[model samples]
Target: MNAQAPHRQRKSWIIWSLVTMGLALFVGANAHLAYVAFASQPDCVSHSKGSGEAHDYRAAKSAC
Candidate 1:
């Protein structure tokens, strides 16, 4: 019984390590995707045409 204990303990450690690594990877991926989604800016912009404060404005979407 004593001889088999070390092997069982090692197996358990490996399984737990793998589980922890998987969770970490999952969390990291989600964080990266969230950052990309929120940090990105819209390419569309509004431009003013004509002269003076009474100028007209035009809106267009960009290729971004």
Candidate 2:
């Protein structure tokens, strides 16, 4: 059982390492997406002038 101790510890360490790396990747991707969302400014397009129109696109309140 003593010889198996090191092997089990190594496996546990590998598993934890993989989990940490995956978590880091997920957090990094979310951060990048948030940065892009805040940094990018989209140009306004033509939209419906009147309200209560069917199948029409409405501009946002903060639209430029």
Candidate 3:
């Protein structure tokens, strides 16, 4: 077959790299956001809102 054009080859490589990097960045950002949201979330409550926090350590969480 005839040789492919240089411009076409470079364009394909550029498009492929951009798509992969875009996916990587999107996933990385979402993971980071999830980590921060959960890790920094307010403690779970089991008091007035969580069984009225009867000083029950057995409570799944504490509040009030």
Highest TM-score model number: 2
Residue 8: error of model 3 in Å? 0.4
Task: Give the alpha carbon lDDT tens digit for every residue of 6-62 in model 3.
Answer: 878999999999999999999999999999988895756544444445663454444
Q: Candidate 1's residue-wise lDDT over 1-64, tens digit each?
A: 5999999999999999999999999999999999999999867555654455655544344343
lDDT of 2 by residue, 10-62 (tens): 99999999999999999999999999999998898776766776877676574
Ranked candidates, highest lDDT first: 2, 1, 3
Q: Lowest-scoring 10 consecutive residues by lDDT in candidate 2? A: 55-64
Which segments of candidate 3 are over 4 A away from where they belong? 1-4, 43-62
| Clash statistics: count for each candidate | 0, 0, 5
- Between candidates 1 and 2, the one scoring higher on lDDT is 2
TM-score of each model, paired residue for residue: 0.65, 0.83, 0.57
57 in model 1: Cα distance from truth in Å? 23
> Which 10 consecutive residues of model 3 have the lowest summed lDDT?
55-64
- Model 1 lDDT at residue 35: 98
